[model samples]
Structures are given as structure tokens and as C-alpha cells.
Target: MSESAGQPASVALFGTSADPPTLGHRSLLEGLSRRYPLVRTWASDNPFKSHGAPLAMRAALLEAVVEGLESPNLRVDQSLSSPRALDTLERAARQWPEAELVFVVGSDLLPQIQRWYATDEILRRCRLAVVPRLGWPLDSLQIEQLNRRGGRVEVLPLQIPATASSAIRRHPDPQLVPPELWPVLLEQNLYGLRSCLASRPPLR
Candidate 1:
């Protein structure tokens, strides 16, 4: 969508499944908002993948996570499906012709990005802002390969990396989520961990 009149254009695209967006996901988006004048966060609706919640439900959960924090320049687009990253970037480019596009991803997902569909094209269209995650080696050979192609990638140095969706899902305490976001999580029914968090009990 073209920026109306004098409005500034979006500069980045944050893409994820966002099965049920967690606090860490919100923090990452907030960090990007600080650096980019216009950032559009989006989630996927992949028919092939088994999502924790239905596509509509996932979208609503993300909407709740970002509610009241919306800005004229910051937008959340839920209309798109699981288009190839390159295709999504192209659409974003068409929508905001003057803006540069950056794709935001976590470090854990960065190393395997080469395996993504049309990854090289995606890289050519937008630079990557890789957020670091705990326990994932930042110095792996795969990272070396990415660095070799580093001209298109920038690693974001996040101050705190301890919080993760997996950790939150695995936490024995059902009360681990902060009060402000508890309703959002519970509303989405994402706290169930029977399959992924085998050792942890399901939230009551």
C-alpha cells in the first residue's frame, strides 16, 4: 500500500508463524520499531504446517499482542498467507516503493535460511537483521557461510536473550507469563505443552 500523502514508508518486514506470539516476540518487534521509522510485522498462514491455533486465531493473538501500541508508521499485516519470503518482500516493495526492506529473523533460524524457498532472491531484495538466541552457536560453520555473504546480513546485538517461547512453554510454573500478557496467551490456548514440552505439565 502506498504511503498516503506525506506519510513515511515502512522499512522492514518481520515475518513469523507467530502460532501464539510470546513476550520475546513482542520485545523483538519493539526493538525493531526503535531502529526503523516504519516497520510492518506479519505472520504466516501456512496450510502445510500444523499450527497450534488456526490461522485466524493466530492472527487475532498477534493483534492483541500489538494492540494500543500501533503507530501511524508501524503496521501489522495479517492478510498475507505463507508466500515465499522473496514474494512477500516484493509485495512490500510495491506497497512502499521508496522504502528499503529488511527481513527480521532470529539467529536460530538464520543458519538454515539457505534452505528456505528462493532464499537467495530474498537476500537480494532485503538485508537480514538476525537476533541472537541462547544456546545457539553464533560461530558455527553455517554462520561462517552466512558471514561470507555478510554484505546482506546484519546481526542485531540484543541486550537480553534469556527469554524464549520454548523456555516459556516449558516452564513448570503456569504463572511465568507477566500479568499484562497472560490473558493474550491464555486466550489463544497456547500454553498446552503436551507434545512439545513433554516434561512440563499443561497449564491448568
Candidate 2:
């Protein structure tokens, strides 16, 4: 683990599968980088989901995206060993003992966070910074439940482009991805819109 020189007192780690990171992912990181002293984006190797591409391939795709941005604060972690959410958080905490670890995630994942392995311990280590997702209702019941369980979650209302990786993967037009990122997508060999649309069912 490498640390950025002259980093702020508070650093955040954004971890995800990032099979093929979308514009929303980029927006969240870019936003957080401005607020925090240091921000590192990590792509985990998940054993649960069937990935569209291999771990190395996905990491390379993320690297391409980061390279295009030319942001020194942004980084891609390519850890081969797939650890659970808690384990990854613990490692980050140890790596940056001086900086407070803020875990960045989407609101859609909040409902299921309790089911994550050692979730209580995970919360103890880092505060969660949630970005709102389209179609996911962050209601009172959910908020109460999260608070009742000692969750240190902070909700941020960010109006991100309503484009999910799954939606792009299943859509008829590959142009669903922003025109600026078309070259990256093509270089990464992500299924074009027509190919993806023909290959999978419509987004629900």
C-alpha cells in the first residue's frame, strides 16, 4: 500500500467490484477526492458474482479510466486475494493509521450491508459515505434500522447520471456510455450496446 505525500488528515477508501466502472462511479470518486485529503478506489475480486471479465482485465479497464483522468489522488488497487468487505476495510485502516477511513458506497447497497460478513466490526473501523442511487428509496424505516444497529453512515444527496453498468451491459445501444468514454470502453472490449442488448434480458 502506497500513501500520497502531503495527504490530508482524513483519507477515504472506495471499494467495489467495479467490473466495468461507470460514470456514476467516477463522479463519486471525483467528488470525494475534492472533499477528502486522499481518496483511493479499490476493485475487489468478488467470488459471489459472475464477472463479465477476468480480474486482471477489469483492473486494466479501471486503470485506463484513472489514467484518462490524470488525477494523482485517484488510484486502483489490484489485490488478487478476494477478501470480504470487513477484511478489506481492516487492511485499509492499518495501511493509513493516521487518516480516518471513510467507506464510499451507493445507497442501494446500504439495505444489505448488515448481511455483510462482520458488518458491526466494519462500521467500528470506518464511517460510511453513501451516494444516492436512482430507484432506491432511502426511507425512514431504512434510516431507523441503520441507526438502531450502530451504523455510522452519512448520506450524501448527489444527483448522478442514471446509468448503471448492468443497464449498459443489457441495453441495445452501446452508446449508453458517455461519448467521452467510448474509446476506453472499446479498448477494454466491453460488449457494445447492440451485443449487450441481444445477449441479456431487459433491465427490470
Candidate 3:
């Protein structure tokens, strides 16, 4: 979105399912927050995947990861809303009326960004900071098309050599998440473990 001539933009958003908050996300938040004034990390719902952990716990995990890093610019919101990016931008606008919103996302999402609800309106609502995922690097031609169509998207260079949350769910690892909060994930039994623990009781 085009910023007003004299207005200042301060708030940026990072929305994620954060099933268990991956190490790559940790890196992205650190790098992005350094550039933006406020980077709000949201634990949003995803219609495609059945979330293993409850919204409250997912948010807690995100907060724990951020807190472990001691990043002052990052904030976590657990509130449930429409899975669409457009809706999140609208909600952010209503809450931070004067704040210029920028949506931070992974590169894998760019190819399908246009398919999102009210894609045009979403572009008009906020700027985009796209992170280059391992397998989903930015396509030059695709970017060109977006720019030509009035979408303001910037490709970020930060890369995290970690796998997706699903992998962590199937095989929990401290390296994939904040070292300090490893125990929490293990003790709580999130993601893939949920199926195993469904008929069992919590660990003592």
C-alpha cells in the first residue's frame, strides 16, 4: 500500500500458524524487527492443517521463543480470526489506526498470494515483507508481475536452515525451537504427539 505523503509507518505484522514456532521464524522475527518499528507476531488459524496444539498454547510457544531471544520489537497475539491475510490486515488497521501496517510472510506464500481473499484490497492495505524460504525462493518474473500490478513487495534475504513445524511435530528437537523452551514442547506433547497422547494422560 502507498503510504500517505506525510504519515509515518511504524507497525509491521508477522502472521503464522506457529504450531510450535520454528527456528526459521525466530530468525525472521529477529531480522525483520530490526527494520520495522513494531513487529506483531500473530498465532493465526490455518484451515488447511489441523492445529495440534490449542490456540492458547501455540501463542505461549511463540511468546516463549520471542522472550527467550529477548526481542523488544516482537509481540505475540493469540486471538483467533479469519485465516485470510486481508482480514488480519483489517483487524490490525482498526486496532492501530495511525500505524502503517506491513505484512511479513514467507516466500512460499508469494506464488499463491494473488489467490488470497481480496488480494487487491490486501495490497492496498499494507506493505509486504516476503521471506525467502529454503525451497520457495523468489521468482523474478513473478515479482515483476506483482510490482507491475501495484503490489509493494520486498524480498528479505534472511534464511533459516531449519525444517517446517510439521517435521518438529513428528520429531521434536531443541535445535528447531528455542533451546530454553524445549522442555515445554516435550512436556506438553504438541503436534504429532497429540495423536499419541490423545488416549493417554499427561506426563508427570
Residue-by-residue lDDT tens digits, candidate 2, 146-195: 66778777887667777677765565355344344555555655756435
What lDDT is reached at residue 79 by model 1? 47
Q: Model 1, 1-204: lDDT tens per residue?
A: 344644344486887777656667777777777778888877786545566666676666666666645556566886444557777887777776676687887777865688778766777777787788776646466655765664267778675335654455455234434334456555545657333334556545
Model 1: pairs clashing at backbone N, Cα or C within 3 Å: 1-95
Lowest summed lDDT across 10 adjacent residues in model 2 is found at 172-181
Root-mean-square deviation per candidate: 4.9, 5.2, 5.1
Give the clash count for each candidate.
1, 1, 0
Report the candidate with higher TM-score, 2 versus 3.
3
| Candidate 3 residue pairs that clash | none
lDDT of 2 at 6: 43
Against the true structure, whose TM-score is highest? 3
Off by over 4 Å in 1: 1-10, 46-49, 68-72, 80-83, 140-144, 147-151, 167-181, 184-190, 193-204
Worst 10 residues of 3 by lDDT: 1-10
Whole-structure CA lDDT of model 1? 0.65
- TM-score for each candidate, following the candidate numbering: 0.76, 0.81, 0.83
lDDT of the candidates, in the order given: 0.65, 0.68, 0.75
